[model samples]
Target: MSLAHPAHTPDMINIMIVGDSISHGSSGDWTWRYRFWKHLREHGSNIDLVGPKDTLDNIRTAEVGDDDATYADPEFDPDHDAQWGRPYLTEKDEIEAKVREHEPDYLLVLLGINDLFWYGVEPPQFEANLREFVACARRANPGLTIVLGTVLPCRKAVDDPDFGARVDACNNRLRAVAEDLDTPSSPLAVAETAAEFIATEHTWDGTHPNPNGELRIAAAFADALADRFGIGARYPRPYPDVPPVALDAKASID
Candidate 1:
C-alpha cells in the first residue's frame, strides 16, 4: 500500500534513470544511479531496475571485475537510459521509446548542464523541452511517477556568471514545469539538488559526480520519493563536504 497519500505505488517498483554524462559515469566511476539503487535495495523491496542500456560510458566488458576498477560496486544492476553528451533535446526524442519498453513505475531525471554548455537552450526552451519530456513519458505510461532534479550548479558557475545565471533561471523554470505537469495519476516531485549540491567538492572535475556527490544526489531523489509518494524509505545519510564547514575563525590567530 502507498504510505501517506495512498497513490498507485507498484509492489514491484520498476525504475529508470534518464540523464546525461554525470549520471552515465565514465569508465571507472561509481555513478549516482549505483548509489540510488543501493539505497533502494537496502531500504525498499520488490525493486526491479529497468532500462535498455547498462554499463558506464566507454567502459569495457572486461573491466567489470578488476580490483582497481574504482566503481564503488560494479556489480549493482546498471540498467539506465543515460548517455554522455546527450542534452534534453536529444532525450526528448528518445524518452518515450525507452519508457514504453521498460514500463518503469518511476523515472529519475538529471539533465540541463549539457544543454546549457552545448545546446544553447535558454531557460524558456529548457522548460519547454522538460515539459515535452514529461508529456512523452506519460504518453508511454500514464501512471509513471517522476522526480526531476533541479539544475545543479557546477564549476561553470564560478567561471562564468552568465552561465551561472542561466543555470539559476533554468532551475526556476523547472520548478514551474514540475508544478504544472504533476498529477495524482502521474505524481511528480522536484528534488532539491541545486541548493545543496556543491560542484567543486562533490565532483571530480567540477561536473561529474565523485563518491560523495553520488551519495548526495541519491539521497535527494530517494528522500523525495519516500517523502512525496511513499515509494522507498528515506535515505538519511549525510552528505560529505556539504554545508562546507569552516574552521574556527580565531584558531589560526590563536
Candidate 2:
C-alpha cells in the first residue's frame, strides 16, 4: 500500500475523478473536475487528470458533446471516469478496470446521488456498494489514495420529506465508511461536499451546480487534498473565467 517507492515519481501525480453527472458535467457547464484542475494549474502542481472517457454530457442534445467544454484552460486534461447516470453498483464493476487502465495516484469519488435520487437505493445498501467500489480500486492498486465525498443536498429533497433525511443518513454512513477503510498506505478521506455545496446557492437546478457552485466544489476537494495528502497548492478565489469554446461538429461522446 505504501507508494513511497521507486514506482511512483515524486514530481507527477495522476488523479482520476470518479462519479456521475456532477463529475461528468453537462454541456456549457464547467464541472467541479475542471475547477480542481484549474486549482492545480494555478498552484503549479505537476498533476495529470486520467480517465477512459474524455467527453462532456451534452444537455442540449441529450447526448455527449461533439467537443469538450471550454470551462478551464484547454491545456488541462479533461479525462475522467464520470458517466451521466451511473450509480455505485455500476461504478463498482468499472472501477477496477479504470484503476488498472489509468494507474492513478488518487481517486476522487463524488457519487451516490444518482443512486438515491434516480434508483431509490437505500442508505445502507448504497454505503455497502461504495465500500465495495473502494475495495475494487484498492485491489487494483493498494497504493491508490481514495477521497470520498458526501452527497450534496438537492432542491428536490426539500419537497420530498424523506429524501433530505436519506441524504443525511447516507452522508453519516459515508463518514463511517471512510473511517473504517483508512489505512496508512492506502488512506481514505471524506470531503465535505454537503457543507460546501448549498442547494439554493451553488446549484442551478437543485441537482447540478452553477459556475459558482462548481468553484465551491473544487475548493472543497482542493482543501481536502491539501489537508490530507499535502498534494495541492493554495487556490486563489475569483478564479479567472475561461470563455466557452466552440465544439467540433463531429465531436461526440464515445
> Model 1 segments beyond 4 Å from truth?
1-10, 59-70, 240-254
Error of 2 at 187 (Å): 0.7
* Top-TM-score structure, candidate number: 2
lDDT of 1 by residue, 1-254 (tens): 42211233456678888888788876567678887887877875556667867766543333322122334456677777777778888898889999998888899999989899988899999988998989999999999999999877889986899999999999999898889888989988898877667998787678877777877888888889888977768777555443321223102211
Scored by lDDT, model 2 comes in at: 0.79
Tens digits of lDDT, candidate 2, 1-254:
22111134578888899988888887666678877887776787777788887767766564543345644343456888888888897889889988998899999999988899888999889889988999999999998899988898889777787999999999999999999989999999988877756778677677887777787778878888988878775456665554333344224545
| Model 1 lDDT on a 0 to 1 scale | 0.77
Per-residue error (Å), model 1, residue 36: 1.0
With a 3 Å backbone cut-off (N, CA, C), the pairs that clash in candidate 2 are: 66-251
Alpha-carbon RMSD, each predicted model: 8.8, 5.4
User: Each model's TM-score?
Assistant: 0.84, 0.86
